[model samples]
Target: MRASVTITGSLEDAFNEWTEGTARRLTDVTEQAASTMRDELRAAMSTAGLGKLGRALGHAGYPGGGNYSIHPAAEVFVRGRAASAAKWEGVIDAFNDGATIRSKRGWLAIPTKNCPKGSRGRFLTPDQVAERFGPLRSIAAGKSVLLFADVIAGKSGGVRKATAGRIAQGRESKLTLMFVLVKDATIRKRLDLDAVIRQWETRFPAMIADVLKDG
Candidate 1:
């Protein structure tokens, strides 16, 4: 969002000084606008049910987690300063604008309903899954379908661990499906960061006027 300050009568002198980049109060106005932008961004994230991710804006210690800085030019954005910055940056971008996430590796293992979450309420990783439940064998369930992988159909056999329990009696528990390996996954756009920016853009002129008026 860009703040265009138009000076008419009483503020013409201040605007002229601002054009030459000599107006000291213009810095104050920029700071106020940037602060409002940061707050609105956090509010927007919270409204989109991304409170945890938004909290990272305040956590400068995190990889790519720095908020806003006061400068003559108003700016609010995430800066990648760490090794894992790209990973964390994608988190914000995915939520801001809808994204299609493809695996960097051969396949991306997505957790199924049968998959268990970790202690931190996050889905278990592939290594964690392997640790908890022995190992998971790979079976190309023909074409692109995870649902068919569990049920017997063609040359592709279902992934199952046969237990000692008698299946002849027909009271044995069904096998568990841990994950669905896919090439890519789609994430719908949920955050309106642009909307917040637009809102601040309109209010920026007034903010500048107040600062110049006070001076």
Candidate 2:
């Protein structure tokens, strides 16, 4: 359930060694485990005469992260298990009665027909996001480029304000370029997201390396 790693070396040397060795090994192991689980799910699906359903089941299975969703078929299968049948039946009943599933990552809320219109299905490729926002170029310069951004719906307004205040009060370096994305109620607010990203691209033209997206 838990793993701990320890390295005996100078701090810098230990960090560098760990980054190259254990960190890379952990990443590889995690990926392999996920792939194996996918294969197992695929095999299970094939045996059930539901290859498409199997593929979907594989996609829904969480391999590394502590989050997963039971596909409709998987839910049925779990409910059919002789030992856990009653418990699973209760779960199925709750799900049918509109109960939200909870996972380690976050609460799972089922959207209803009356749910407010929002950017649910929209996505931006890394390149498109970068092109719109420009490269976060300044992040590479000076003693350190202190990066700050508002996580969507993050409850840390005071933290953000204090961070900005610290920079203003000369407690933090002026070389730090701040990036703030305001989430607005409407789709039009995302137009602002594009502009804020572009400003970063324009301001720190020299430091642009790569842009990443939350998968």
Candidate 3:
């Protein structure tokens, strides 16, 4: 997925006029602006809690004069991501466009607090859980779920994963809720990518001036 900001129309003409009769090149200034916008977008992604996706941004363009036609009249563009970094695009798009996720197969297995964590403390997947305790015992409810043990082990609330030694010894053990089966899940529109682009878009001309001034 990608979002971009482009300078066109009077903006392009104004930049050309600003750089008239000088050693400054449009390509150089545009590259600087694109780089600056990429950095700003990356930072905003972090601020919006989409830091991983934010770092995926890549800016490209600013070819020679004749290349303008191929580039849609913009010297450069701040692109959100590339194909190599496409894994996190869905997440970014979901936050930007808002989404309702439904299971493509059957039920969505959402990890519960009682679910066992991996060595890194991340929640284990269904296959990993199955490796630990074989096929999960299903419980009958509105949305059916698979549990570690048939009976809800004697505990306060949440499900538990019984230890290997306890199960072998035939002793009562803690059983935690592994997963909650749900039909769908919702992601709200939290990140406004267009707003971010516009914010930096306004600063582009100033960036060009700054580059020329420094040069």
lDDT over C-alpha atoms for residue 4 of model 1: 100
TM per prediction: 0.61, 0.24, 0.61
What TM value does model 3 have?
Answer: 0.61
lDDT tens per residue, model 3, 1-215: 99999976798777666655233354555666677777776776788787866766777654545343212213323244466445466777788889998889877888877676788978888778777656676676775665553223435654344666656767566444677777788899988777867876678767656655754
Error of 3 at 204 (Å): 2.3
User: Which portions of model 3 show Cα errors greater than 4 Å?
Assistant: 1-25, 60-84, 116-122, 143-164, 167-172, 205-215
Q: Model 1 residue 64 lDDT?
A: 19
Model 2: lDDT to the true structure:
0.35
Name model 1 segments beyond 4 Å from true: 1-32, 59-75, 79-81, 138-142, 145-174
lDDT for each residue of candidate 1 in 26-124, tens digit (9 for 90 to 100): 665566567667777888888888876775553121111233222346566554567556666789989889999888886778888666677898988
Local error of candidate 3 at 4, Å?
A: 52
- Which runs of model 2 end up more than 4 angstroms from their true locations? 1-11, 58-215
Quote model 2's TM-score: 0.24
Question: Which candidate number maximizes lDDT?
Answer: 3
